[model samples]
Target: MDEKRLCLAHDDSLRMLRLARRCDDLVLAPAPARVLRDADGSIDPAALVAALPNELFAPTAQNPVDLRFDDDASRSGCSLVRSCPGLLRLPDDAYLEVLTAEGDPLCVCGSTVAHVLVEAGPLAMTSAAVTLGRAVGAGRLSRDAALVRLTGFAMELCGRYARDPLAPLVGDVVHDIEPVSSVRELRAFLDEPTGLHGVELARMAASYANDGSGSTMETCWYGVFCLPPRLGGAHLTRPLQNVALDWPAEAAGLVSHERMRPDFHWPRYETACEHQGGDHTSEQALEEDSRRARDYELCHIHYLPLTKKDARDVNAVTALLAQLLSIIAPYETDAFARRARRMLNDEGVCAARRVLLAQLLPPRLRWCDGDA
Candidate 1:
């Protein structure tokens, strides 16, 4: 990263830190340099902790956000848990504890606010968290707890915002409860046209977007919720159109594109499915499946299949990388300030500097092992 760009990222992290503190939304963790062992009996632990920021090392609540629940949740089959495999891994005790926490219903798994809405019969008080708990705890505890937890959050969000037409839309899709035997099945479910159930749900989402009656959740719904599944799948034509009509020119620009106007070539989910050798899936296989899914998701956004050399492709890759880095970059703090200065003063910090700078570098078009 260029000096200017690095400084900019540094500044952004500092700003984010301040915002996090003010909003009480973030915790800082800092990684200090470690000592090195030389052939000569000289040991410098400090040498190991390079430019790792203090903000990142400090204990914080954000670490759990990095976890991706790709485990099989069949601990015991339950209606909600059976539908989403990602939730299967949570221990029974932990699963129940999270659901029962008292707060405005939110996905504690990550800081993301729920976007999907659902019907929670006649509740005078509607909170996203409460509604989510209700969904997860609806039946016997036997099921994929995580799916019930996450999808419940989605469904709850939909319910709380029932006044907003988009609520029904989110409710229909998220609460449909498909019994996904594997990640492949889940991927297929997401990629396929919304079944009659999904279509009806989408139609509701569109109706809400179209009528423009309850635009309160527009930002959350479009900017964050729809992003993961937006690029492909489902008949989004009408919803996109409705969004285009309702959103300001700036927000509309984010979701709308020329290709969006036309019918898109839908992929067959079978192609994306990984073939695990045996009936009993191993941890290694699950790990492999997770790797494939990550690649597939990133490829959907970053792949330059047809235009390897195109400037647009280059720009997209770079922008995506920069945005990702911004999301993960450690915020500035007393320790970071000291380290930043030291990195400038000492050549040793150059390695740390490079890692941070890579965020600003134009993302390469070729495949990378990970976002790092």
Candidate 2:
């Protein structure tokens, strides 16, 4: 953020520009001379490489760095390097499209890399999510994995002031947007015809994805409730995620906190659900959860809190599904409950969630044994 330092958009910045190439060329580092250009405002590979730190160019194949144009007209190619690390790549056509937006996407400062705030965060996330869908279509990544990331990224974006370190780098990249509204934005991006792969799968996930998950665990639980039976989910009505719960006169004096937000809220059914991870099991935490549940009850809302143990058990999840279905739709309760309960242990579901947690969960909370 310091304006004086040469700051290039680090890894995965949507604003970062690259010499476009085929899929094969994407992983291989570009020969310095080939990518660095003497053309107006562009880079010169050799000199820039010498001046830049090795960290700038060492990003993993998953998330590559972007090269930018030179700041000075006189020395068009020796731009200094300011880089960080993250992962995303814009397809050739999509990369060029954003530059034409109203304001200048890139703002260079100093003799080296300049700090940049690209509005293209949403664009990059959308592309990254859908582009991964391409792997799903090709049998590379499971639908569960792709869906978890897409939905997880969406939730992080929707958390307003809260940023999860485990979430994609986009949490800080974009400004004001909610979960469902962001979904609309994603669809809008997809609406424009482009060569992005996995369009169909991307569309489906966007429809099911919502905002406002408080943690990775909540996201896992939310994913369980919303995805269809065929896709290893309970197929329940998608709940409003981490929405506000207003205190009624009867519920007053129940809790000292001025604001209350549940992990999942369903207005029509008057129901709410919370995922209690290990962090919530302390005596103080349990007592607070008890008080909050009482407050929710006082407010005439059904509060359902599930811990990590319940998530690992199929029977427990099935019963929970039955309860959820009964509240949301009595007619479909038993059959849907039975069918979807098996998803808790399904390989695809477990694998998907496992990878998601590994990538996004903070080191202290990560686990690979199963979904939690």
- List TM-scores for all candidates, in order: 0.16, 0.61
Candidate 1 regions exceeding 4 Å error are 1-66, 69-372
- Summarize candidate 1's per-residue lDDT along 1-372 as a digit string, tens digits: 111001001112222222222222323221111101001111121221121224332212332111112333322121111121122222221110011123222121232222111111111011222333444468632122322223322322232122211232222222112111222222333334423222222222222222111122221222111212221111112122111112234434344232221011113211121112233257885675555444444334211111222212323333432332232224334663443334333433323222222221123322332322
User: Can you list the residue pairs that collide in candidate 2?
Assistant: 6-113, 7-113, 8-82, 10-84, 37-43, 41-70, 63-87, 80-112, 80-113
Superposition error at 58 for model 1 (Å): 5.7
Cα lDDT, model 1, residue 369 = 27
Candidate 2 wrong stretches, greater than 4 Å:
1-11, 14-41, 44-64, 67-121, 130-134, 143-145, 160-181, 195-198, 253-257, 313-316, 326-372
Count of backbone clashes, every candidate in sequence: 28, 9
lDDT by residue for model 2 (49-97), tens: 4323353244333443444332344233233332322223432222221
